[model samples]
Target chain A: MLLAIAQPLAWFLGFDSLMEFIAFVIAAAVAYQALKGYRLSKERTLLYLHFSFVLIGAGLLVDGLSSIVVLLSQFHRGFVVLYALGYTINFIAQLIAYGLLVFAYLQQTRNISAQFAATAVVSALFFERNAFAELILIFLLVYITAHTAMNYSVSKATNSMLVFGAFASLTIAHFFFLMFILVPIFFPLAHIAQLLGFLLLLGMLLRVNQPS
Target chain B: MIPGEPGSSTKPVSKYRSQFRIYVDVMQVIQREKNQAKPTRILYGANLSHDRLIKYLEELKSLGVIQESGTEDKVYSLTQKGIEFMNNFKKVESFASAFGFRI
Candidate 1:
């Protein structure tokens, strides 16, 4: 819902989709790894992580496909709806994905309860972007980033540092997205920041799976 | 035997560790002892009772990750598969720990 660019930029069309596609692959890989860990260790937190990344990958795939569709359609009036549909789906997916991540953190700290369940998803029609939604996402990312930061500080491990950087980058990307409403250039900047975030996450994954 | 927490030090002591965790802990003890450990070392290192350690050792042996030897003392060492499993487990543990989640 933080997406403010009703129409994606023409110049960055292919590149944006490519970046998102790559990010999608990385997200899916992370999810798969989390699932493997969950199966091996039966960790509930890993399960939550698996689902969160799954949703993130799904959202990225949908958005990337929609962007490709828009680019191929040449912004046809009829096809413009696809853009909205894609963004809306991606928005909802991210909302739930981040919410699940936040819930996972809360559960880790034993702060989660039934009361937070109902407030998890704020129902809204698709294609509706608002400050409120953006604020929620930023809030969630901040908490997750803080948690990762603490993790890095305690462990002083490169992988933890990467994860912390990735989340911090993502938070910045969302902030840029929120600003994109006023500054057109912020759209591309947001995408670049987001790609960097995912790339950092990919780095962590590679490190995690690297041969011992 | 003594079973500490799982994966990393950050995790609080839960009432029980999963079977998988116990297996990893036992293997870790073997690894820490330079890949050859006695039954008593495993029992003490993994924080398991004598009965539980015996049960898990049997299970690990059946799973092909560990093997027992020594006619008189019953020393244990990791098999090839067991070594690979431990390697993989270390990776998974680091990954989970990076996210502040214990596996």
Candidate 2:
């Protein structure tokens, strides 16, 4: 799987875990806002957004916690498997999360065929992720970013721009992650980009909640 | 029907306003008038049939979110509970709109 990059990032567990924890918080915040919106409006898209972020936040937490455990155990043999399990779970979570996002976007167009195609693609992605999870994430993020970009182009609102930036950052982060397979240095850069993506989402949430 | 809404297939349908949305629009008009609005102002602002406006107004009154006053000329205002609900609804609207989804 994409777990090959995890071995090198092990050396920087402290920083990596911290970045992930912060990203987790940001993801939860995004999920919370989506939930709040859903409750008020009963919007299915918002509900999808809520669940997707919840999955993302859960994945980050699990992965980060596993890393912390491995670090604390001084890389004991038994604790090491936890790292693999964490990576596997995180990979699967991201797979489903991004799938839901694509589903939400397709829902807007009300295309049943597209929805079925998405489900099939997501199923296909499961096997593909086992080979290169990062690439799959990159692929999904690219589609999401494209949708958000279209949203910004049409709405021309700063909030829409922020959403677009957030997804774009995530797409870049996944690209960096895919590159990490070739160069180890790309690992930290990937985390930085991922965190930037979440931070941009945080910025949007803050602006959205601000008194008008 | 608008996208994202339960059972809705398309976005905006700017011409279509949900009953709930109409309710919010009516309250907003009252709030915009400093918590006291005339029926004509509400009819124009919410773009509702006079019959629909009166029906919705009665509905709001029964729901305890809005109150009626100025019996001679007829005026409407939001109750404290209604004001709080509107405030929360505004947050929801803002959040949904941020993602370019209209609620």
Candidate 3:
């Protein structure tokens, strides 16, 4: 497929990091398209799902750009401060994306009130500097865990493999980050995970389209 | 048959009313298709029966929610009105969610 070819071509062109960023942009486009589709369908659950995807895509795009900059050059001491600030912003964006996803899932399950409260709390907590990152990560872990559980609860849903793949990829990426080995490794792995996730989701979409 | 007229019987008015209602419902479905811009895969995620789906599809095609893409197993997509309706539906959903109503 075009996507499969695009991935390696980006690397060969000395824009490996940029490829990941481009993937984020692609995701954003897909999300936007899906949002429009959901709107046309008048499907509330699908709308929220696409909205969540849009936020996630935006976060990934920001993270991708930051990684690209880091990969291309070393930052000076003063630049390090700027980079740190940027990292904080990126982290906050990611947290917001995760929060939106939680809300989307809750809406799908018809648990609107709980989702609303959770979103507000998560958003508020994201602003607190002390322990903010750790808190957000904790919340993200909880959300992912809960999402997996909910997915399991729905027997008719398809393409769970994609979900598992994404989770596994993220887990490995985070593990590497914790070890402080090479930060660049995380970006590529995350992209791989996202790519797999999207493919899996596409499969699910096709399944839904299948005739009974 | 008209029961009271020359040994003929007729269907009740209620039956006619029900039929009219169904016709209106089908028209709404058709209108939904007419408004979409692209051929969209209409997934009956709610698992409607084949008979019901066929009826809905027929109505939608008539209303232009969908159109025959080609000679192949004609694919269907949404028209502009369909898209607008969908967006409105999403707005309602968003509003409900804002109120913690769970869609």
Best of the candidates, DockQ: 2
User: What's model 1's TM-score?
Assistant: 0.89
Second chain TM-score, each model: 0.85, 0.87, 0.47
A40 in model 1: Cα distance from truth in Å? 2.1
What TM-score does each of the candidates earn? 0.89, 0.88, 0.52
| Candidate 2 pairs with clashing backbones | none
Residue-level lDDT of model 1, residues A47-137, one tens digit each, is 8899999999999999999888877887777777887788778877888888888877776676556356436654422325687778777
Which regions in candidate 1 have their CA more than 4 angstroms from the true location? A1-9, A114-119, A122-128, B1-16
DockQ of 2: 0.43
The two-chain DockQ for each candidate, comma-separated, is 0.39, 0.43, 0.04
Q: Report the error of model 3 at residue B54, Å.
A: 15
Docking class of 1: acceptable
Per-residue lDDT for A172 in model 2? 90
Error of 3 at A75 (Å): 2.3
Residue A10 shift from truth in candidate 2, angstroms: 5.3
lDDT of each candidate versus the true structure = 0.81, 0.81, 0.47
lDDT of 1 at B21: 82
lDDT of 3 by residue, A1-212 (tens): 11223344335322534544655665565466456544444445446556666766666566556544543444334444444454456556656655655565554444456646575847565365434454555566456645654554553233444444444445444443333223334444544554555554444444433443
> In model 2, where do residues sit more than 4 Å from their true spots?
A1-11, A113-118, A131-133, B1-5, B10-15
Candidate ranking under TM-score, highest first, comes to 1, 2, 3
* A76: Cα error in model 2, Å: 2.5
